[model samples]
Target: MTANERDNIRAAMDRLLAGIPLRSNGALTIVRLAEEADVKRHVLTHRHTDLKDEFYARIRAQGHVPDSGRRLRERLEQAEARLEALREENAELRAVNEGYARVVNLLTLENTELDKGDGARVVPLRRP
Candidate 1:
């Protein structure tokens, strides 16, 4: 690779690692690196594999996860928690509904029993 190309790639790598990209979006990926360097994607993938490997090594050494990936993980955790809470609430509501249903059935049976007379004739009370 030409010295000018090497210089550009190194500068791009620095800018990306420092979270200050000028040419492309600051993503810790080879595609973004190529874009940042203004180089063809295949140049980095095929021509300068060492540079690419070094970039990944530095990222790994820093233990830096991409911002987007980290945020997605956090959101997934929150969604899972919310789902669990909803499931618990749904179960409680179902239990309450079942209790209400039982109460209504018991009341209906009582009403039916009351509607059936016990073969007793109505007696008129004599007023004194």
Candidate 2:
């Protein structure tokens, strides 16, 4: 009714946006919205008709502005596919790295032996 009271209702609406769940757990209801906003339900219904309409519109909209559920689902699927590809690439790289390690080890041993045979200084190999 009063300007300060209306401001309180608006503030409550902002808080409700964060507390209300999207779709999985539980949808935002007027009752839950009032609870989060710390205001009585009547404040939304009688005192501020515009706020009440906005609240219901948001619930109906289900945050359709940015990415809707369908789009989010597609993106999630794409991400999962990309993750699988990365995992496979990681496995392949590990195998290649292991092969390189074995070759490096063998070559280092061969070099050490040659150095000893020719009286050349044997340099210890440091791992990179």
Candidate 3:
């Protein structure tokens, strides 16, 4: 990387670490770093790989989690919670449906028996 580019990257890194980003959202990620530096993302990932590594190392040393990573973890937890709720709801619905099916079957059998009883009670009359 050129000296000017390296300087810009370093300054951007400092700004990001300080949470005083001028050009980016200060998310503690490489993409945000590049945005802060006013450089392309490939410039940091491909050309200044050392700087990229240094940035990550510094973040780790400081026990800092990237905002994007934190957000993803939060989203995962929420999705898992939602999935569990849906599963419980599905189980309840299945049980209710089974109950309805049993009641319907019993009612049908009773109706059939009533029809048979009516037929048996009818008498044929012969006129004299």
Candidate 4:
């Protein structure tokens, strides 16, 4: 990319990172941001190393770097908390599902016994 394009892309990213919400379903992924900023994905993903210093320098010149770090840390902590809560919820759901599975298995066995007199076979049903 040309110097001007690179600068524009960097500025767009800075704005996106600053303005985009970090909450669930709120944050924009790198690819999405790149698309929104009209920058090539490869430039954002691979060419970033070449641009990092200049990008940081520009943002620093614009007085955004120091506060950016704090904002990033706060967002990271919120993300971690959300992840922890999701994990706990997943564990609870798994426990409840296991309970349901056991109950279903027991009921199936009892049903088999009850159907033995009719010579009925137990076939697994397919789920939609």
**Predicted model with the maximum lDDT:** 3
Models sorted by TM-score, best on top: 3, 1, 2, 4
| Runs off by more than 4 Å, candidate 2 | 1-67, 118-128
Over 4 Å off, model 1: 2-7, 111-128
Q: How does each model score on TM-score?
A: 0.69, 0.43, 0.72, 0.43
Which residue pairs overlap in candidate 3's backbone? none
> How do the residues 6-115 of candidate 1 rate in per-residue lDDT, one tens digit apiece?
78889999999999999887999989999999999898889888898988898888899987789999999999999999999999999999999999999988777766
Candidate 4 structure quality by residue, lDDT tens digits, 16-110: 55665322222334554456556776776677655545545655666654444778999999999999999999999999999999999999899
lDDT of 2 by residue, 1-119 (tens): 47876776566666555555432223355566566556677877787788889876775576643235567899999999999999999999999999999999999999889877868
Clashes of 3: 0
Stretches > 4 Å off in candidate 3? 115-128
Regarding lDDT, does 1 or 4 come out ahead? 1
* Local distance difference test, each candidate: 0.90, 0.70, 0.93, 0.66
Residue pairs with backbone atoms closer than 3 Å in model 1 (clashes): none
Native-to-model Cα distance after best TM-score fit, residue 68 in candidate 2, in Å: 0.3
Q: Mark the 10 consecutive residues where model 4 has the least summed lDDT.
A: 21-30
Evaluated at residue 112, the lDDT of candidate 1 is 76
Candidate 2 structure lDDT: 0.70
